[model samples]
Target chain A: MNKYKRYERLAAIVKIFNDNPNTLINLEYFMNLFGIAKSTASEDIDILKDVIEKFNFGKLITVPGAGGGIKYLSISNIDSYRSFVKEMCEKLKDASRIIPGGFLYTADLIYSPSVVSKIGEILSYPFQEKNIDAVVTVETKGIPIAMMCARALNVPLVIIRKDSRVTEGSFVSINYVSGSQRHIRSMSLSRRSLKKGSKVLLIDDFMKAGGTIRGMMELMEEFDAEVVGAGVMISTQKPEEKLVNNYISIFVLKNMDEEKNIIDIEISDWIMGE
Target chain B: MNKYKRYERLAAIVKIFNDNPNTLINLEYFMNLFGIAKSTASEDIDILKDVIEKFNFGKLITVPGAGGGIKYLSISNIDSYRSFVKEMCEKLKDASRIIPGGFLYTADLIYSPSVVSKIGEILSYPFQEKNIDAVVTVETKGIPIAMMCARALNVPLVIIRKDSRVTEGSFVSINYVSGSQRHIRSMSLSRRSLKKGSKVLLIDDFMKAGGTIRGMMELMEEFDAEVVGAGVMISTQKPEEKLVNNYISIFVLKNMDEEKNIIDIEISDWIMGE
Candidate 1:
């Protein structure tokens, strides 16, 4: 085996940790990879802990005992993330983003990988330490944001299909009323997609009255899944009351006047205070 | 400005590159970030190039001259990825994955972040140098994989909805036949999601006769977008002639013996040869 220098080992370690976020890695793995002594590997980790903290990249947690090792938890700096969200708000304020209906054309923003990846990191931040087993979302628009959140939390994404398909095998489905449109729709999840008693975080791209999210919470009940948290990328303000009482949003859609070609949106108060 | 040691800088650089795959990074940004001279930054990049290749992490390209910078492309080692796909095949053959109607239940594997992240890298590797402007996929099952591919390519993802929603604004809709079910269905995409004349890569979770992909190709024509390439995770053996002539699949399903609980599956020869 070829021996690696100190700097080379450090660089490789960072890459490995970043790739496998929230995964517990044994020091012996690195020792074996670089053909280094246990002491040297430990020293490298110590330096990494400092570098990660200093840069506000994330947190490096060390678990004690033979079965435990180290994990890199993604936690972006609040100030910088707030600024990023502010920049997005400015972009969303453009009058050209208004569609014919009362909706804002946000497909471009929500579907961008770089943009949603950061949104995922921010949305998953509050639940990172909650030991979330999975991230769940109803099919159609919310899948991308939910996938990114799942990626950040290092968990499997369980997508609830709007309509059941034969290819999903045996599945549990539920029907709920759409808060905004007041229409009933059914959503289903494959039996194997989620585990019983698993803790899950609910994610969506937008929420008008939180009917879909409430529907998801009910669907999770059939699988004996515990809904640990719920997050949405954007939420409308007019309803004042949502079907679900417990959920947070990144941006609050205060107003959208299609005729005036104006949109009033801002980051949520909870996120700003963070 | 705070000064960083050579080892610290190396570790941080790796994290940055890993976080922003396929994004161009100016050397001056690093110089300003570390309060280091351009020559020092150049030396750091040289060492990174050697380290990246030595470890088979990915490729680092230095774009020479003005208006150019360095970019990190996500390219997994072919041998390692082949083995990884082989491992997946083993798990898929467990007999329990078979659902009724001769369909194999694969949600558990495809929804996995770690698994699909690798799958995304392998699928996008072929078209990384193709200057893909976007990764396009139909909604429901393929979003996660496509999002990861878009992330790997540093491009936006454009999802085609099986049914157009009012919130999508003005969209182009098309009808096509479902290859396996022999049913006609319609898919739509927002006009703003993709730019005209943009080059796009198509991705899907599974393909039977490639009808959906072919329909996507037709839809792309409406937007004047170029379909540079198409890829799927799994393709069936029967109906060897696909609806679309130009597309690739990672795994080929030769036979599925539901009664005997046997699944004959393996990585595609094209990928194995790579």
Candidate 2:
């Protein structure tokens, strides 16, 4: 093939891995697509994986064995992504503007590409093979990660609203507990937002008591959708806080103090040392 | 190119379009990447656009002129996607589960991916080019859309909490007056969450009187982060009540009543027909 063809070949391989991160694929498909020998296709896949991994895109894992397939995790090359996230968190911690007992410049967390990549990686573990029809979360903050999972899985995102307005009329609501807020604010969803029997992945920015997630679960059940997995950007390693299984978290915030400017944050145990 | 190579090329072009939606590009990037001239690159891009648009992945808008480039807009592609979202809203509208006035199946709006996709498309418009540092939302539900937008923009999601807890230590808070929710909530964010001079894309699931988003802006000020743009999933077209600027809403629930089984929904004008 000519140079243009080679570029096209490499680009196509990268796209496939990106679209189907961490999903198993066989050599036959590659052979058919590239019209290359099994050996050539394998080499192409290898080259694509190496370059993508070099860029900190922790996607496209090749499996070795019978019935092996490639899995796209949508993660960054581990160290780069983690370091990027860690840097962001540290910056937030240092910025006195983030007052204690106040809204943690959490909004910043949602927009940082590096941070989102890491969080997406943590979330992929559970939803990798399961039939995830949609990703669900409360709006505003959760939209970022939810969207990531949806793209990775090629699904859609469902949002839950906290207030009832004429715009999202005729909905199902649950009066459970709130997690960080710790108040009895009501959460609502339009009656027809989620399809019945479709499996869903739940995601959020942070999890403290898991009350909001539970409320979401209750609301999700009202639509008859199954909760396939759950994930959060950060989760507190506290007690009585089991929200969902097969979930992953990127980091765990440590002892934090607003006045003295003391806070300890580290990668979550679930993600670190993996 | 081989069959696989062809598909991979298509995927790369699609992914590029996905990242730079509604934008234009020159053939140089592809030409250089593929070691081909503009002629071949243009042909491949055109082919890529046609095939993908057939599937409603998004439309590729080709711009002409010296600075012309290609852009992608995620629109209706999959039949199931649209129907699924509409059905989601319908499910929440079901009568078996009803809440008080002014709120129906709010959860459905927040959780539906199809609906959220529309929301992402709208919200992404304002921050498509700027160096967006983060996507911010008050914790809980906002996480979902924040996730979606972050993924689309390849950013991280940061969440501010309503209340500070023992674990999170000190937090800065602002009183956000909510006319729709009808109460002012003390929203808080951690000191370590944001950075100075950072551009933030603020998002929330619902916009009624705009208290929550406004509160977030106030918090952003405390940290000196630039409020680059703000968007909402649903904006109540209440006359003269503007909560967010440069905003977009997926659908408008014009009418909703719990006992009357009356609910009206329509696509938001901000994004549709654009």
Candidate 3:
């Protein structure tokens, strides 16, 4: 192939892997798609890997030997992650974001594609190595973040809805107490959404009493699935005793003085440590 | 500074633009980030644009004069899109996907990031040149597709909830009849979800009677926003007169024979024409 054609192939490879992160792409698939020899395919993979590493764009993992191919993992550098968390902290400090019930408004941030995509990349880092079958989240606010993580992990996203619709057919619904409000609420998942004995990662926009995450864990039990990990974008420090213990948070909301319009938020130790 | 460094920069730029399509990235931002001169930045963008065009990846628009920079527009080639739609049609042809109410099971497809992301890209193509401020969808089933469209458009996603939540603060609610079922349903949007006078794009997984999209339009009216366009992953042909016209669909479900366990689907004319 000519030099320009090689460049074009490299660009196409980057896009294909980037679009399907953490999913293995066998050598045969590329060879068939580009009609290239094995050696040329290997060279193309090498060039892509080098570019990813040198730029800290993400990680490109090549598995050698039989049954091995290449996989792209979505991860951002520590500096970028820290700066992103700090910027999020600053955004949450806005007085207008503080609602009547002391809940910080996050719709704007969570719904922004650029913001959630970055957050998803950072949050999916630790779980990338795990054999996760699906990324799960409760319906409503957590969908975008979970979608991003699912994209990063190259897995299906299973959303637990607040109510079961007729269109969903059969679903398993479970009742759990709201961690913060201490009220019983129901969440349901379409029976077809998950498979038995699958490894699942739970992601959410916030963690209060951890009731929601705990509820999700109980719901997963019905499907006979294992909860490998759980992560949230924000968590409250007030709830020193969380319902679910092993979880990661990107930001810790230390305090909010409604009257004084003062809010304190900082990057979580886990992220800062990175 | 070096050939390898240039490749690294090129890869980073492609990823950045891909992650945040249809958004502007100022030349100065890249120059400052790389500590490169204006001429070098221009050359870098030119190379990236050439690769995208040569590979049929997407479009890179360079805006001249002040208050302008470069923007990446997501548009897949027609052949790839037709093949993708055909694959989806094959998948939907499974007899099991046909539920009791003649509704096709789509939770599996819509929740899959790869599927939804590709659908979002194809759906966003026509609206790329339009000035769209946000992508809106009725919550639960449509969130993922809307999220993808919002990502492609580089805009925020606004989800309309079936019921208002306290966490959303205040919201505007509207009632509309289900186009097919002829049942009254209500959907609400958070007061702060979209800015007034914003131009919005609507997206959903399926369009039966077009009632939901019409309801969304009515809901958007409460916010003083305009609906620029609407797109769906699948639309049924039985609905000869749609409640909402001027919408694009990826696939047309021509027929569903339950007894014979067969489904006839074709790529949308809009997609095939491209």
Best by the lDDT measure? 1
B25-70: candidate 2 lDDT, tens digit per residue:
6789877665666777778877766555544455666778888877
> What is each candidate's DockQ, to 2 decimals?
0.83, 0.21, 0.71
RMSD of 2: 8.7
Winning model by TM-score:
1
> Per-prediction TM-score of chain B?
0.97, 0.69, 0.94
Comparing to the true complex, what docking class would candidate 1 get? high
| A240: Cα error in model 2, Å | 17
lDDT of each: 0.89, 0.64, 0.86
Q: Can you give the lDDT of residue A158 in candidate 2?
A: 73
Model 2 misplacement above 4 A = A1-123, A130-274, B1-7, B12-98, B126-133, B166-171, B225-229, B239-246, B272-274
Off by over 4 Å in 3: A1-6, A30-37, B1-5
- Candidate 1 local lDDT, B172-272, one digit each (tens): 89999999889999999878888899999999999989999999999999989999999999989889888987788888999999889899998888878
Per-residue C-alpha lDDT of model 3 across residues A218-256, encoded as one tens digit per residue: 999999999999999998998899999989888888898
Model 2, A1-274: lDDT tens per residue? Answer: 5233545566555555554544567888877776777777777777666655544455566778988866666655345455666676676556443444543445445555545544655575556667677788775566666666665665666777776632444678778767656778778877667777879888988777787788888888889988877788876665445655456677666555666766566776544445
In what order do the candidates fall by lDDT, top score first?
1, 3, 2
| Chain B TM for prediction 3 | 0.94
Error of 2 at B231 (Å): 2.3
RMSD of 1: 1.5
**Between which residue pairs do clashes occur in model 1?**
none
